[model samples]
Target: MRELDVAKLPEYVEEDVRVSEWSTVRVKHCAYSVPSRLKGKWVRVRIFEDKIEVRFADVIELACERLIGRNLCRIDYRHVIWSLIRKPGGFARYVYREEMFPSLVFREAYDGIQVLQAGTKGDLEYLRILHLAASTMEADVAVALSLLQMAGKAITSDAVKEMIASSSTSIDVPQLVSPAVRLSEYDALLTEVAA
Candidate 1:
């Protein structure tokens, strides 16, 4: 038993990979997205059984669930939203376009926006909403979109932003005032106990 190595072996396989211009790394025939800032940079990928950790400059940058099948992709919209916002036309033909929608509400909002403004204009508006979601809290944006849809209001990024701002402003939290603690009462109790 002493001859056996006491140190534990790493369960993950490590590899060095370069981030593509699209901010993705191909691992085991699956594409996993990294942050846009890591584009064209070499990163260390530690592939575990269930997840993969991407590291740059010895610091962990991204951790994604490992894809099981070939030609599969795990694309995070936040990683690519900036470029898509710049070129809204590319959204129509984006290979992983469906992955761009963070949730059903976002998809519905896009459809609604398309109904209001067709072609590239709708795309731009939807991209702006997505950008808002990526930058701000997604749940907040989703709630704003849901509220706008419920009210039968036109769903635009600006409308969602306005809704969010108004809702945030309207929140009323009751102030809690803690009662002053009395040390004299405790002293009296002690005196009574002594007597």
Candidate 2:
């Protein structure tokens, strides 16, 4: 058997992709979301086995599980939640709306909001909740939703936010104590030197 040179092998393929207006880039015929702030910017996409990593200005922005088939989309709701909060009306027509629901709890929360409110109001409320999940701890949001669901209360965004806030524990700061300095130690050292 012959030995192969390490430098002759290519680790991955790089492609320069322009992030679309929707905050996504096309790679392997599929769309993947980048950070919303990175829209209208060029990103270097590194295609690796089992994942596709997107980088902007040498900093890794995000990585997605590469899709095997064509025309598929992988979206993280957190990546675009802020824009959706500003324009809730766009949810209905958003191409990747289905991917926004990260879990069943979030889906159920959105459904509950829709049942309680009407039209764009419900969408806005759900977007706010999603935004909260994106901004804060998602596990905390899930716990809050669970509590709200058990209480048979409306799962509005404000309710979820309050529940999360109330459930969080406040940290106590400890007072600093300065150690006393003894001048006698220095005097003893001077006396020993003089002797």
Candidate 3:
């Protein structure tokens, strides 16, 4: 066979797409969410077998698992939470509302918020908590939510933030001391073995 070109053919198919106002790009009939900053911007997408990578100025900006079927969506809360925070009311009827919950704990927290505060107030509170999770560590926020729910405390973004702050401040790292090393013990063991 003749020698291949200097550069090998890319395994992925590349295409240029414009990010929709909702910060999503339609690929293969499926919508994939990108960063909010990419809204209305043209980006290059590298579609591989299992993942799609979005690049701006040849720098990868987003990479996520490719959707398998038509009309499916892969929405990440972090990518859309900022916009939702600005208009919390939209959350109730948002098309991919269920996908907004990053985990069962977050969903439970939202339900708990609803129980404490009804209607739009609860939605805003839940959105705030979600925004906090998107900005900080989700596991930390989840643990704080679990603790508050277990303790029968009000579940609010501020309360979760306080819980996280308290937990972080209370961490006690034990001081470690290195033990002294003695060559004499090893020498005695060696002498005994020789004898």
Candidate 4:
């Protein structure tokens, strides 16, 4: 029998996380409908053991980790992301403008990411953020994740840009997370950015 570490996959990556014997799953292939903004930035998680690894297009060469439980993730990022971008009243996208420039935003969650959470409540919220972010190329969650990866802290897209410019590592720019997420999901975004 085989198993997956559900601990690594955060919310917003998929609708739900189903842990089962690895042999029970058909790993033939899986694909996600990501937003245009995230074209070159999309990746899929796969479990290798106790830890999870993130890779470009589910390919092993781009593997970002070699741990456990990372493979178990959401199939679609659109569902959750749409929920956040839809606005508080269930309509309209929140737009923040910098002088003539404008960008959208998305929130992480109230509880936090799976790894940071104590149980399902917190994990679910993070899952929501991850799923939402993964669904689209332009979600605020994407930028938030990118920021979390580099800055070692959570902040808005605009703030992330500032950090990236300052880092000077010349590493991969996480991704363009335009339009800050609505509400104060900043804390949540930061918390779940890694897992």
Off by over 4 Å in 4: 1-112, 134-140, 154-195
In angstroms, the error of model 2 at 139 is 1.0
Encode model 1's per-residue lDDT on 1-195: one tens digit a residue: 568668987899999999998889999899988889898999999999999999999999889789999999999999999888989998889888999998999899999999999989999999999999899889999999998899999988888888888878899999999999999999999999999
Candidate 2 per-residue lDDT, tens place, 1-195, comes to: 998766755667899999998899999899999889999999999998688899998999997788888999988888888788999899988899999888888888888888999779999988888899999998899888878988999888888888887777555678999999999999999999999
Please list all clashing residue pairs in model 3, or write none if there are none.
none
TM-score of 2: 0.81
Give all TM-scores, in the order shown: 0.86, 0.81, 0.83, 0.23
Model 2 worst lDDT run, 10 consecutive residues:
165-174
Best by lDDT: 3
- Candidate 4 lDDT at 163 equals 44
Question: lDDT of all predictions, in order shown?
Answer: 0.92, 0.88, 0.92, 0.37
lDDT accuracy of residue 188 in candidate 3: 100
Q: Point out the higher-scoring one by lDDT: 1 or 2.
A: 1
Rank by TM-score, highest first. 1, 3, 2, 4
Query: Which is the better candidate, 2 or 3, if ranked by lDDT?
Result: 3
Better of 1 and 3 by lDDT: 3
TM-score leader: 1
Worst 10 residues of 4 by lDDT: 93-102
Runs in model 2 with CA error above 4 Å? Answer: 1-9, 170-195
